[model samples]
Target: MPTENALPQRLTPVLEARFGLDGGAMFGIIPQPLWSRTNPPDDNNRIDMACRCLLLEYPDRNVLIDTGIGTKWSDKERSIYKIDDQDPGMTDSLEARQLEPADIDDVILTHLHFDHVGGASRVDEQGDIVATFPDARHWVQDRNWSWAMNPSERDAGSYRKEDYSFFESNPDAPPLKLIDGISEILPGVEVLPLHGHTFGMQAVKITTDEHTFIYLADLIPTTSHLRAPYVMGYDLQPLETVEEKKEMLYHADRNDWILFFEHDPKQAFARLDFDDDTPRAVPVNPDEISAIG
Candidate 1:
């Protein structure tokens, strides 16, 4: 186990891709008049979303929290999602930091959703799908992997076979390590499994001596979802989601943990304010944290 001071030296938000999703589905039962106030929808009823990933820099290794949606979409699919990969995208973000895909030491996948894990593999010049981080070990929950393999009809469309099929088909691919339950996959890094949005979806908790950070995957996709009732319609178990949010938010508020939102288009990090009837997220600048350069 790593001591308190042995936590990551730096944290970087890797902006991968920009896309859009149905605002109605994203806000669940929230009235359009309410949600549209914050996240205005496009003519197609889609709201802007970001596939943000986190990069943790340690003394000996660089760990990536998630791989955003990769470059493997057809013209029809791109138009539907309003996919945009050119502006400060994954490759450009990495290059700006003087790093390459091969430099990643480990990949902690929050879940196997197409938008989350699509960048894990890519279609090479030779036209073969292969691991993007060839040298890194990809970590995923065992139950989530099983669920992705045989997804329910409700979310079957979210799982793209081509995005992850290379893991099993390619013998020479990087190792895929499936973990069970809450486990510390790295020093000072822990993963907690939440099943409301999707079976076995994991949220990462990184602890340091001075501060703690929680990578809120789809559990709390955006700051607008800080309210207990703002669960997404895509969630299979809304009640479970509410209960889970209550517990997570209680701890987060009590501990003053900074939350990293994956799908929030405007805000990347925030601290909670529970003084109001509906919990509010106070936006925190990523540059404010010395360790999060």
Candidate 2:
């Protein structure tokens, strides 16, 4: 049970699929030796990553942040990314909290990347990909929606049409709400658009009277990325990513915002410490804050 000073009763982290990415690509120009010390790479030079989502439970509506990589991968594709077969995935995570997909009222997709939004839909029994949360209204940036529909050559592979096309083709599926720029989708849930990652990838900011939690989607994928220059090579605009990260980090440190990492493998939530020249992500035990279920 959570104490009075712990995380608000409504927030929990919903873990999804586990996958791996190339260490070099993940850390960009950072030397292998420097990054390998913390995030040791496997024989295949891949580092572990987790598709962790944030779930906000409310009396009237339940909200879910980015869904993980869905179960639509072929064996070859799974092998390429080194996806862990043992991960209990989204359904199990939700069941642990005594909720189902239908219970989710809104889904704020940080972006349309396969790893982030893949679980938004699934392959139905009739051999068709369908929306996973039939009752939830999916929210995404309009700029990002257009970019994903027609991605550039550099990031074409990241956008999987099958993962989200169902929302457009199937009228029975829940509505896909596309918003422009930053806006409050819900009363206290606001989506801030950041372009350094993809085109218009948004980071979710959930504010309460006493706490402010920012779901740092791919902007700051992991705790290791706390350093300004440790930007991912996967980012389209690496320099832009550095500036964006620095600004976000400064504000997060000053305001003492709890950052929810989407791709961090081991650590789920962290608070920034700016005592040193560089800001560091001090991992906070989810149990201490009652932030994970």
For model 1 the TM-score comes to 0.97
Q: Candidate 2's error at 170, in angstroms?
A: 1.5
Candidate lDDT values, in order: 0.90, 0.87
Backbone clashes in model 2, listed as residue pairs: none
The estimated TM-scores of all candidates read: 0.97, 0.94
Predicted candidate 2 versus true structure: per-residue lDDT over 1-293, tens digit per residue: 42333323478787787899999999999999999998999999999999888888765677899998888999999999987635778888788889899999899999999999998988889988888999999999999999999998989999999988888888798999999998988877889999998899999888865678899999999999989889999899988888888888878878889998898888888888865678778888766664344
Residue 70 of model 1, lDDT score: 90
User: lDDT tens string, model 1, 36-63?
Assistant: 9999999999999999999888877889
- For residue 6, give model 1's deviation from the true position in Å: 2.7
